[model samples]
Target: MPRSQPAIPICPPFPISGILRAARRRSDLSQRELARAAKVSAATVGRSESGTILPSINTFATLLAAAGFFLAVVDPDGNVLQPMKTRDDLRDGAERLYPAHLDVIPDPEPGEWWADIYGLARPPETFYRDRRRRDYQRRLSQWQVRVSKHRHLPEPRLHHYRDAP
Candidate 1:
């Protein structure tokens, strides 16, 4: 029997159409002019604004840039979130990215590595930690610091809201 493909989740429509229209107005650019600047078809700009089509992330960002604006990711407090740094220098024997769940150690001492038992010489500066040992150390630190009892709490209520019935 042929295997069935998993259903891809469809995202609900966003207010990107309105945002693009507003940005175009602010930049004083017609749809055709914006399209020319963004190197897209005028129909594409029109359809995007009319909600007939949803632009891909790259296309949306390009259109916004043409309208003298840029897209950004921000928190509820309006703080811009920075993207995670890429560590191109770090990799394993197969050159695949280190497992994100585990901590990676660099230049470990001899006999500390599992592959050392086989007497295989590893590439320079490549090292790994035992997952169980790392987890044990993390748990021990949490217990010593009593992290469970003092876990993060929500912000306090405002003074005005405190008196509200």
Candidate 2:
């Protein structure tokens, strides 16, 4: 059975999606426009901002890239606390070159832990690095693909939703 996200915390207030919404507004892009740029559906953005959605890692990454932001939990002075990447970005990259294995399979024995050939310890960073690498490769490939296909892709303004169709 799949587990669900814990209830929203009341104190420090996890409002990353709010940041996305604000960024989208700053970009002057509608939900549909942001969705298209992010390669996700507009409803996804709607749900996320409304707090009805718990975005996958990859989805969040796409949103960040689309909204022109990077993922980093930082202190008031801008010291990075947690570096994060979206799962969708990694999965998409993985899908392009190799089969994506972005998920962590839980140990059935509950106490068991296994290290893979990559020498990743019991708790591995493979999942994070895999997504980050994939995100970079996918963006690079998309740029190449577009340049080869279209002679030019404008100075990267917000993509038209109709263009996606």
Candidate 3:
């Protein structure tokens, strides 16, 4: 058998200091001029270019804007990723933001949800358990119907849950 080589992990470029310096030079802006434009101190701009301290996202964006540049996030294939819009209206009973991974369904039908068995009126919007649980329950119910019609028990289908980031 031939020996296999280990896969090398790919790292994205992150030369922020170099990028800032280049952008400032390209825009013909001195450190003090850039600082004044960005509403930050000249020392802060110098320290950022020298990599003495890393700026926050907002600060970095501001600095870039002052140097006539803008920051953007792109995928490996160079596709720009837009930020998700904030949903101010949707909220749980405790007014906490729902997990982004879960799907939010609006106005579920009666007895269509597991929580409906409590006899309380359904909320206007809600999120259920992961899809695996719902799929398993649906398949199990169908299997039960088949078993009743054939007068014999059969192995039921199974589902697996996928964890979300």
Candidate 3 RMSD computed on C-alpha atoms after optimal superposition onto the true structure:
11.6
Q: Compute the lDDT of residue 65 as modeled in candidate 3.
A: 98
> What range of 10 consecutive residues in model 1 has the weakest lDDT sum?
153-162
In the range 47-122, model 1's lDDT, one tens digit per residue, is 9999999999999999999999999987657899887665877787688878776656677678766788899885
Give each model a TM-score: 0.58, 0.40, 0.66
- Candidate 2 local lDDT, 109-163, one digit each (tens): 3233333545544442223234444444555657767887645754333323344
The CA lDDT at 47 in model 1 is 100
Candidate 3, residue 7: lDDT: 78
Model 3 worst lDDT run, 10 consecutive residues: 156-165
Candidate 1 residue spans exceeding 4 A from truth: 1-13, 100-103, 109-165
Of 1 and 2, which scores higher on TM-score?
1
- When 2 and 3 are scored with lDDT, the better candidate is 3
Ranking by lDDT: 3, 1, 2
lDDT of each: 0.78, 0.63, 0.80
